[model samples]
Target chain A: MDEINLQRQSSTNDELVLIEEFFAQLTKPKNLDSIRDKAREFCQRNSHLKIALVTSGGTTIPIELNTVRFVDNFSAGTRGSASTEYLLKTEQYAVIFLFRHKSLEPFWRHFSSDELFSHLDVNPETNQVTVCPSFQPKLKEVISEQKKSENRLLKITFTTLSEYLFTLRELTMVLNELGSKAMLYLAAAVSDFYIPPENLAIHKIQSSEPLRLHFELVPKVLRPLVKFWVPDAFVISFKLETDENILLLKARNALKRYGHKLVIANELNTRKHKVTLVTEIDSESIQINSQNDEIEIEQLIVANVVERHNQFIHDQSSR
Target chain B: MDEINLQRQSSTNDELVLIEEFFAQLTKPKNLDSIRDKAREFCQRNSHLKIALVTSGGTTIPIELNTVRFVDNFSAGTRGSASTEYLLKTEQYAVIFLFRHKSLEPFWRHFSSDELFSHLDVNPETNQVTVCPSFQPKLKEVISEQKKSENRLLKITFTTLSEYLFTLRELTMVLNELGSKAMLYLAAAVSDFYIPPENLAIHKIQSSEPLRLHFELVPKVLRPLVKFWVPDAFVISFKLETDENILLLKARNALKRYGHKLVIANELNTRKHKVTLVTEIDSESIQINSQNDEIEIEQLIVANVVERHNQFIHDQSSR
Candidate 1:
């Protein structure tokens, strides 16, 4: 047991070194300071309201320094965006939405180019544009809700994996001031491997030759996030898998390693309809009534998470 | 010279086998039949108008069969969309725009989400939504142009490399009936390499180990496109390079290899402001006069291309 402990310590030390090198080589995002300021102001302004740092969409790993090519994780930000809308509806939480640029946004996801254009009417003589009568009610509701949540919602966009990590760290540190009232709902599909800056090509990779690539594991930031950054916050991380057999086991392992409050375990194909919430003590599955139902699974997921977060806050205060 | 000829013949034979295998493994795009029918109907209806197939945006290469991860090329469809609008302005051309899903569209590119919403006003009393007066003129112009070109323009969308290629072939064959009047404007930033379906992982690739990937060169579809599919069509291919020194040489090489009508060569950094048009006998560079010029380079590029196309038709008729 002692030998095993020593080996684990050595592995952790190596990881620390890797993380340090990773950050050292990364160029800080250009809008880091402004985003940090926005997040700080949001947290301070909503001191009474519970703050949720809801990360959405997928992060990209560039194969070239000039970034003509990149490896991307597949996510439309559906879960994160839908969950944000639900959380805002509860009136108890202020959200910092750190999302991928051009991915779906909360209320905006309902309108596609065709849907928006099809419902618009143009009065050529008056030089006016109006939403058709049938679409006005839905548009008005979305617009009003958007206005109500304007002050409570802070949006910060990131494109690359490095940018995402840098912003996530900065925001997490800022939210630490909130103590037990903060929640980290990490739903972004971050790339697990990346070609580091030094190894990336300076220009476009030519098509003249067959391509070979080697990528190193992206340093696991969740460890430092949970253990050091904001241990008092109610942390929730997501586990998405293609195979059902390993989904719960992976979620349980993540909980053991990170010591986070909950793991939202989901299979890729059925994720939109069902999810399993795995806490330290037990796991519970949540599913929509029917596949054809109009309800989003995020509606149920956010409610359950909110209840658990409330319990965590209450437990802390009692202790 | 004999030895070189033998080697070239062998290489060509190998490439043919690879192309055959590639298509054999690819699944046909689901909407291929509908898109083909649309293209055919447009061609038959507008037989007198010249047809231009303008491909835009970038194709993605899936790393796994389930496609949780992908390698993507960087393209915004700016050049293609802008060029299409300019082509339509000529009034003598009809465009079949084959584009990446969710990339910029011809007239719709002018307005972003924030731009669109900021100009919108909600009226709760009458249950109405209207565009603000200040933004009315621009909206009117875009909407009018969109309506005018509704019959002349056909839009088709693809996301993955296989889908792009399959649809491209099907569309090219359908456009073949138009003969020399058909102009192929190939501008899409297609991936140079891809992981074959047989070699791709069936599930999500585990993150426990460092990733090593080998990608085969995507077969040169341009050869078969020019030589077999649409030999009589006036084809214009684009060559993009980061290195200025190799740009023209590569463009010339492509013309010689594919026997296409023209090659539009552009350096990666200066593409927005300048491009060189390369034909069999000579090359000409076109550039916007000033950095702050409101005119898009695509306008100039399309005008020059149309002039050459006109001369080609005249020469053909004379022959």
Candidate 2:
């Protein structure tokens, strides 16, 4: 009975309703065609390389159409960006990074805007500034690697939940043409509830009275995404919960329902320190502790994922 | 009867209750005492100069104690930041900027992270990057001016509404010692509603079910601030409304209720384009459009405000 209910929930018409409403509300992102063209050209040029579609940061749900206020999930794009750096180090894949506006990004994520300034010294005489000596090694590595992969990496930003969903679907469809050569990492903290276009207030919400906000469940885009859009590609989804007891259960359920390749489960507080990788065959907890804390956990997570990805490619080619 | 009711509301036990509750919930900011000491030192060393306390950006109200999600107002700190730059250019006043973390800051706000990178080139042979020639003149001017005023400027950041209120009260108490020489610019778009500490969930709110959030009204800190904290100092508050018709009315009401020196009235859509400066004696609309669009409205607003501040000081001294 439980399985039947879960199956029913996955196939519900609610998803179709959501997709329709979402499309109706979208204002076709201005650079959509240009981004699509660039991605196609990059893929064609780097045909021998494995390609990654990494979605980072959190998507926001505007409380009002004019958006004086918003409902925001807590994601700084640390995991996705750090993982991208690790993936790039392997030199095996071209990356298409779809991220939330103002969130962290690859390489640059390691330094804040203030820190960037502190690492440069103004030459008062020449009226110019250059990178300070101590930081030269790291900055040089980043610049060189970035130059090498400039043609292979594309970054696009989305702010609202609707924009993210539309872009995600479009990007996945384009990448699907590559078959098993494509990999999708859905790391963005997407909102579970949203005020549909028809229900959203047209102006900034008034604060004169007690504000009562009503949110509807966002349609499960993962269903259509896994079953139809990019069925051949390896997909990984994230499951974040505050309660430890329910974390694994929710993650397993998501894996079973969505039929995705893996689910990364984590507790909100300890997310940076630990994460559990759940797959059909096994569940593994990855941790960064006092001794190994010097190393970022994403480095380990990405290495393990790359190994599995290589295995997947070999198996597909052999078959 | 209306005046009596307004007075009663201002001194209602509700405000006291809210203050007590707010303090009880606050975790002393890590650098509170150090920041206070620095401000005191700055004030003493620069006793001859005027000092402005500018609060910018928007404060967040976390939905859960663990805070995986939050309710946030959309303010990029443009007005406060731009105004600060203008005030600094006068070289007459020292500034203490209390702003939302990661929001735009005074001089640096003018450049985006991407733009900063675009203005630099990395030499492969030397493995060092330098600012491109075209951008050097502007960068030099900004750097020199910033260096000249570094000692007179202090910046502190706050993220949560509780932190902002606590810091505001603490800073105001310190500044009150300066008496008529101090000015307060409350430009932050603080949250009107928040999930109080006692009512907040200990964990991230579960999204499996429909989310129903309950929020309590945030006490009007401006009342106690103007009435007791810094009664002798010039206080300017902002009134932002979506409806243009209500904008000036709300600003006037606020001025009467709080007895603040001035109120800046603005409609949401036209906030950047125009604003009405409201005072007890008069109101005036300041705008930048077809002819003066090249000029930032903050420049004009800051100039007018500085002129009034000068007149206020002269008037007080004569009395």
Candidate with maximal TM-score: 1
In candidate 1, which residue ranges exceed 4 Å CA deviation?
A1-18, B1-18
Residue B59's lDDT within candidate 1 is 96
In the range A87-199, model 2's lDDT, one tens digit per residue, is 88888988889999999988777678777666766786765866677877776677666667667788889998878887888888688998888888889999988877777
Worst 10 residues of 1 chain A by lDDT: A118-127
Q: What would the per-residue lDDT of candidate 1 be over residues A132-163, giving only the tens digit for each residue?
A: 78888888888878878878888889999999
How well docked is model 2, in DockQ terms? 0.56
Q: What are the per-residue Cα lDDT tens digits for candidate 1 across B1-319?
A: 6999999888878877877777998877888888889889989988889999999999999998877899999898999999999999899899999999988889888887667876776765765677778887888788888878878998899999999999999999888887788899999999999997889999999999999999989988999899878888889999988888999999999999999999999988889998999988999999886566689999999999999888877887788
lDDT at B128, model 2: 76
Which sections of candidate 2 miss by over 4 Å?
A1-18, A25-30, A291-293, B1-18, B25-28, B290-293
RMSD to the true structure for each prediction, in A, is 3.3, 3.8
Give the alpha-carbon lDDT of every model: 0.89, 0.83
User: Largest lDDT belongs to which candidate?
Assistant: 1
Worst 10 residues of 1 chain B by lDDT: B118-127
